[model samples]
Target: MHCSVPYPADHPFPIENLPYGVFSTAQDPEPRPGVAIGDCILDLAALTRTPLFAESPVPAPVFAEVRRAGSRESVSNLDAFVALERSSWRAFRRFLHGILSREEPLGDDVLVPRTSPETQMHMPITIGDYTDFYASYEHAFNCGSLIRGADKAMQPNWRHLPVAYHGRASSVVVSGTDFHRPSGQILASPGDSQPIFSPCKRLDYELEMGFVSGCFCLSIGAQARLTWHHMQIYGGKATQLGQRLSPQQAQEHIFGVVLLNDWSARDIQTWEYVPLGPFLSKNFCTTISPWIVSMDALEPFGVGQYAHEPALLPYLEHDGGVNYDVDLTVEIKADDDEYHVVSRSSMKHMYYTLGQMLAHHSTTGCSMRPGDLLGTGTLSAPRPDGLGSLLEKSKLGREPFGLGSRKDMTFLRDGDSVRLTGSARGKGYTIGFGHCEGTLLPALPLLD
Candidate 1:
C-alpha cells in the first residue's frame, strides 16, 4: 500500500483512500454509486463495464441493482451491496487499490465527472431501529454522579452488561438536516407540585459511533442452521465462519462508522427519566454524517478493551475483548465565534464492545438487521478535559468554563453549534468519518 505520486497532499480522498458512497451530478439524471479517489469519483457503474471488473468477486447483479436503484438513494436495503463476506471485501479492496495505483492508467475514461461537495449524500441506509448503548464508563460515571449523587452513581449492573434502550429511528436524519427544538412537559423542580409544558431549555449533542449488522440474524439457531446446511449441501464451510465473533469479526459486521450526534434536552430528561427512562427529552431529532466508513478501513486502529471488574452472565460473557482505538473529539462554536476543542476521548473507553452488545441484545432471540444502528453511548475519558457532555463538564450548569471569547457554556444555548469528528490512523493514510454537526435554533415563539 505504498504510493509514489501524491494527490495534492490535502484532498480528502487520495489514491491510498477510496471510500465509497452514492453521488450524482447536476447533469446526471440519477444518483449512482462511486468511490472517492483523489478529486474524482470512480464511477462504480462505469467501472463495472470495463474488462477489469468483469471477473470481480462482487456479484454482477449487485452493481446492476445499484445502477437501477438510482444514485442518492438508500443503498442499505440492497441485499448484495454490503455482503462482501470478508474474503470478497479484501479482494475488492485489493483490486481497487491496484487500479488506483500511481502507475495505473490515469486517463479520462477511468474518471467520472466530479460532483460538488455541496451535493447531498442521502441517508446511506433507511435505519430500521436505533439503540443507544451506555458503554463508555467515564461518560456513565460522570453523568450518573450528577443526577444520582456522587456516592451512589452507576447502577449495580452498569459494568456487567451493555445497557441500552430502543430509540425512535424515524427522527434520525442525515447530516446537514436542520432540527427544530422539541416541546415537552417537565417538572419545574424535582419535587414540584405541578408539571410545566414548554420547549426544552438545555439542548445538547452526544458524540458516539455505531455498528451495522451484516447478515440478518433470524435467531442464533437460524444462523447455526444456515452454517451447517451450507456446509452439508455445498460441501464447503460458510465463508463467514465461526459462531460468536472476536473483536476483529465484530469490526467486519460494521458496514461503516458515522459521526452520530444524539440531540438531547436535559430539562425534559431530568423530569421524565425517573422510573421509566428518557421519553420526550430524547425522541426529537438525531443526526449522523452521511458517509458510512466501512469497518475494514478502520482495522488498523483496533486496540485493547477497557478493564472491568464485574462478572457477566453466560450469554453476555466473552474474553472481555471489546473496543477500538479511534480517537474522538468534540468542538463547540458560538455564533460568529471560533470553534474550540472541548473534549478528547477514544472508543477504547467503552466498557463493552459492539460484539458483546449484539450478543446480549439478541440473547432473547430478538432479530437483528443490516441497517439497524447501535449507538456506543457518549465516549468520554476519565479526566475533565476528556469529558463528553456539557452536563459533566459544567457540573450540571452550576460551574461555567470559559471558552476563548469570554463565552461561557453551562449547556448549549440557542444558536450554539456543535461538531464531532473521528478518525482511525494507519501507517501511511487515515480513515475518517467527516463531521456530524448541528446548530440549536431558537424554540418556536410561544403562542398567545
Candidate 2:
C-alpha cells in the first residue's frame, strides 16, 4: 500500500513501519500519542477529533484518557493504551494501515513535521520496573573468559535459565538525554586490596534490545487460562501475585521493542559486582529509543532462534522462529572528532528468545505490570568486530580501539557520545528503532 504522507526515499518510518511514540510540537506543547510516517508524525489526539478516527476499531475511551478534559493537551502517558489486548492492538494497526494508505489524504493539522526543531519526543510509556537479562551467549562467554580462563568461561547454571537483575526504572531516560558520568568505589590496580571512591574512569555503553511488557492479567486454573474479556473490560489490571507464565503464554505480554543502551561503569562494576551483580555502576542512567516498534511490524523479520544445549525445562521451552533478524550497529562521536562506527551486531546473536526470558522471569510466580521493561543484554556477535560493548571490543582495556587515527578509546571518555541503531529489512522498506543516543558529561566535582 502507498502512503499519502511524503517521507524521504529510504526513510526509516515508512508506511509499513508506523512506530508509536509520544511527541509534541511547538504549536501543541503537550505530549501526545503519535506514529511516525516518513518525516511527519501523525498525531493521534488530533486524529480522534476528526471523522477519520470515528470508524476506527481502536476504542475511543483509551484516546480520551490521554487528553485533558475540554483540551487537546495530553495529560498522560501511554501506559493505558499499551495495556490493551493483542486483538485490539492488531485491529488498531489494521485500521491505521487502511486510513493512512487510502486515496483521501489527512489534513496538515493532523500531522506534525517530525524534523522540526519545535518537535520533541518523550518517553512513550511510564515504566514501572526494568529487568536486564544476560541472554546473549557471546557476551556472557566473552566476559567470563576475560575474568576466568577460557576453559572455565560459562557458569554451570548460565545455560539453565535466563539470568537477570532488577534495574532502576526511575533512572531510565529517553534517547538524546545526556548524563553525567557516574562515580563509585573501585580498585586502583588489578591487585589492589583497598578500594577508592572516585569518578568512573571506564564508562561504557551496552548495545541491547529492550521489550516493553503489556496486558497485565491474572492466570486462572491450573493451565493458566487467560480471559480476553477481563482485559477488554478492566483494561488490564495488574497481573496477580504468585502467578506463573508458561513460555507459550509469555508472547502476548510483550507490547513492543526499543533500542536500549545500558551504560556501564566497568571499574566500579569490577570492585562491587562480586556478590551482587550491578548496583550504582549501572543504575546511574539507561537510554532507550523514543519510538517503539510493535510486534506486528516485526513479524515479517522473524528468524530461527539460537540452539541451546542441554535442553531447557518444559516451562521455558518454546518452539518456532521467535528471534528477529535485525542488524544492529554502535557508533561513537567525540567533540572535535569524526563519527566512527564502533561495533556491529544483530538481534539473532541472542541465545535466548524474548519469550523464553519472560517465561523464565515469572517461573517463580512473579507478577508483571504494564510498561515493565525487559532488556536483552549486550547482543554481541561471535566475531571480534561485532562485539557489543567496549568491555569486549577493547579486551577489558588491555587493548584500545581506534576511532579514526587521531583518537583511541578503551572506554567512553567525557564529551564522548554513543549512538545505537537497529534495522530489520523488508521487501522494499526498512523497520528501524530511531537512534538510542547519549553523551557523557564530566562527573560531579568531589566534595571536600
Candidate 3:
C-alpha cells in the first residue's frame, strides 16, 4: 500500500492510488484507456510493451485486443476490461507501480506526457442498466418532512431497508455533456385542475454516488440457478462466447465507483411521484464522472454497516457487512462567481450498503451484467447546510437560504453550476472520483 517515490503533492493520481479511465493525448488519433498517476497518464498500450505484462496471468491476447479496441474510440469500455480477476489486475498494478514510481529509463517508454489539463477524459464504460436507490437516512428524513409532517417524516420501512427505483440508463451521460431543460406537464394543485405543459420551472441536481456491477452468470433453463462470477472472466476470450451460464461459478459483480449527478425537476416530481415513482422528473438526464475508482483500491476505506432499527430481511443480510467510509461534498457556484459548500456527508450514512443493495436487487432473481449501474441517492447530512438537494435546503421553496449576492433562492436557475466530489482518505494517498459537474441552461421558449 506504500509507494516508493512521491507523485506531485497535489496530483490527482499517485502510485498508491492508480484510478483507471479512458483518455487521449492531444496529438493521438483516438482515445485509449489509461491509469492516472502523478499527473501523467500511464498509457496501457505503451505499458504493454514491457516484459512485466508478459509474465502476468491476464490473457495477453485479450488484454491486447481490448486495449486496441478501446484506443480506437473516444472512450474505452472499461466495464468489460476491469471485470478480470483480482490477480490479473494486481499484477498489472504492481507492474505499473514499479515502472511509474521512479524516473528510470525503463519507465520513460511507458509514460505518456504530463498533459492531463490539455486532454479530455470520457465515460469509462457503456452503462447498460441504471437503478437509483434511496439509501441516505438524512436525505430521506429531511425530504420526507417537507411532504409529510415533521413527526411523520420517515416511512416505517425507511429505517429498515434500501428503497430504489429503476431509472433510464439511456439518459445517463458523462460529465461535461450539456443537459437540455425538460418540458413536462405540471399541475398547479392536486385534484384541483387540469395540468399544463411547460418548461421545468425548478431544475435541480441530486448529489449521489454510483457503483457499477461486476458480472453474473445466468442459466438458460433454470430460474434459480443464477450465480455470481468473478469479474476477471469478462476480459477473457470466453466472454465473447458468453460463458455466463447459470450453473457456472458466480461472484460479486462490482466494477467501481463514480461521482453521479441525477438532475431532477421538483415541480414535475412533486406532481408525478405518488402511487407510482419518479418518471419524467428524473428521466430527463443524469451525469457521471469519467474515472472509475475500483473497489480493490477502496479496500482501506471500508467501514461497518449503517445502524438499523428493525429486524432486516434475510435477503439483505451478510457476514461482516459494511459500507465504504468515503467523504462526499457538493459545491455550488452562483452567477456572481461566489462558491459555497452546500453539503458534506459520508457514504457511511447510507442505510444500506452496496452489497445489500446488490443482494436485494437480485433476490427476485433478476439478471445483472457487467455495465449495470446502481446509484446511491442523494447523500445528505443532518444539519441545515448539509442537505443535498435544493428542495430540502430551501424547505421546498417555503423558506429561502442566503447566497451572499442573492437574498433568496428556490432551485437552480440559468447560469447556476453544481459540482459533486468524493474521495477515500488513506495514509498518504487519496483515491478520488474527479468532479461530476453541469451548468443549468435556460429553458427553451414554449409554443402557444
Which residues of candidate 2, in runs, are more than 4 Å off? Answer: 59-75, 218-236, 446-448
Best by lDDT: 2
lDDT score for candidate 1 against the true structure: 0.68
- The list of candidate 1 runs beyond 4 A from truth reads 2-17, 49-51, 55-80, 105-118, 189-191, 217-252, 445-448
- Which of 2 and 3 is the better model by lDDT? 2
Give model 1's clash tally: 2
lDDT of 1 at 294: 63
Q: Which ten residues in a row have the lowest lDDT in candidate 2?
A: 66-75
User: Which of 1 and 2 is ahead in TM-score?
Assistant: 2
> Tens-digit lDDT track for model 2 on 175-239?
99999999989998889989999999999999999999888554573323335432332344556
Output the better candidate (1/3) by lDDT.
3
Lowest lDDT block of 10, candidate 3 = 239-248
Q: lDDT score of model 2? A: 0.84
- In order, the Cα lDDT scores of the candidates are 0.68, 0.84, 0.72
Q: Is candidate 1 or candidate 3 better by TM-score?
A: 3
Q: In model 1, which range of ten residues has the least summed lDDT?
A: 229-238
